[model samples]
Target: MPAIISHDTGTDAAESLVYTSQPPVYTYTTSLISYALPPSQFVTPETPQVAVGAFIFTPPGTSPPKVLLLRRAATDSYPNLWEVPGGGADPEDTTLLDAVAREALEESGLVAATIVEFLGTVEFGTSRGNWCIKYNFLVDVEEGEVTTNPAEHSDGRWFDLEEVRTLAVTTELMRESLVKAFERVEELRRSRGISDPVS
Candidate 1:
């Protein structure tokens, strides 16, 4: 089993991993969305590999908001398994959050507009025996058609909570992350007065 660690910025419950370091905030804005970097740990030379994931939901006011999930290409590591749009952070990425926005756009053709919150981090061992720490966040994206990169992902769709529970997610950690994202969305809706029928 791959080692796992999480830190949910939306809650007060402490977990095995707690990120207190606040890096400089960076912002990226599109016509529809404004992406901002939240307080998070920086990637250092000691870390072998780091990845970033974006959990984006359907626009507000939808009966039951759905989160986007991508189907990995048959030739990819977890072929045909569904996962969020993300990948390894590139050296040119100014910050971990920048990687999140870049990967989301590259994989799903969605521009990350606003980074809602930092969901947490997931640590797992790669197939090559290297360890990778992936940081995930709840993001809002500009209105656009979902088009996945054929080489990396075969398909992409928005799935409701029930559908997500039944799908073949890439990893158990990923499923948990998706579930938490749903819960967070619900909270946001209630707080913002966006009416959503209970599911």
Candidate 2:
């Protein structure tokens, strides 16, 4: 298991808590990543219907890094729209991070290797008239092919930052999240003295 590291913004408020893990040396395991606690807001939801979204990037050496996105099946809620791999957290999930890894695997057949950063969260009303809060994270997955589930998603593709602007992403919040993810990716690369193709 990778060491879990977290930082709080010196506040007892729920939204101030942020959890992350130290960068891991890629290894294959059933428990791919570990997390401490999700923000109180997500865990204490009145309905306990929290969801998780993952923003996975291509391996470090891939020039012009891209993010994986899956197109929803026509029968789904956001029919035919492109979005990151994610869904509602299940009771069987040990932690919110587990939900992240599970959703990625079930929806896109990708194994999460590390929980890089907490992107943020979004809350919206569901079709059933209940609010759903989704915690988004930046994740690094093991090297492998992507096989999206035909029932939940119709197609899956890696889109560079430029190409993301051209796709019909699920929602405005999701579009903003993608932009923030790209910015975060560039920051991470620069911090490690890696050259960014767009820079």
Candidate 3:
């Protein structure tokens, strides 16, 4: 499952809608406390799925090597917890990359230039329920600084990889995914004889 923050800016009707992603097989219902979802849904091996996430990396600038993180505002589920930029894949999205682009634009106001590689998936644990997968990808930020959606996230910051390693990440699965991807990025750079972008 993926959650996003949205607001009505009026320029576009979608700006007013905050979108979330669950397996397409599931339907959402209304509730006074929060949106209601089925207790459990099943997905077949052929079920339609979407990939929606970007592991953003910035070469060391004024700061040491940095990656972006969003602090989720206290709410249902992972309230007050921090996460990388991601959401559900949109129905209209023709490809996983398309879903990734839309989520990045809505949540972080960042545009993607290219997808460097497919890092893989992160499972949040059975406690989070089934019927969903968090697809992670390495995206090259083509341009622009990050401006966050106030509704979904309280703040956004750039943190050194080492720094994030020191923090208490609530989800161990995601932490392992990030660490592996980060190492792969470094390995690629080394294979090409490219120096650390952040250095």
Give per-model TM-scores: 0.78, 0.78, 0.67
Candidate 3 lDDT, tens digit per residue, 38-97?
Answer: 211212343334345677777423234456788776663576676788876655663455
Off by over 4 Å in 2: 1-35, 38-41, 45-48, 197-199
Instruction: Give the per-residue lDDT of model 2 (tens digit) for 1-199.
Output: 4332211112234332233323222222222233443423356555556888988887665678788999999998889999999989877665677677778778887766655567888887787788888889877777677898788899999999888887899998898899888888877776666656652
- Going through the candidates in the order shown, the clash numbers are 1, 0, 1
The residue-level lDDT of candidate 2 at 28 comes to: 22
**Model 3 spans with C-alpha error above 4 angstroms:** 1-51, 60-63, 125-128, 197-199
Candidate 2: count of backbone clashes, pairs at least 3 residues apart or interchain: 0
Which candidate tops lDDT? Answer: 2
Report the C-alpha displacement of residue 92, candidate 2, in angstroms.
0.4
Q: Output the lDDT of residue 60, model 1.
A: 69
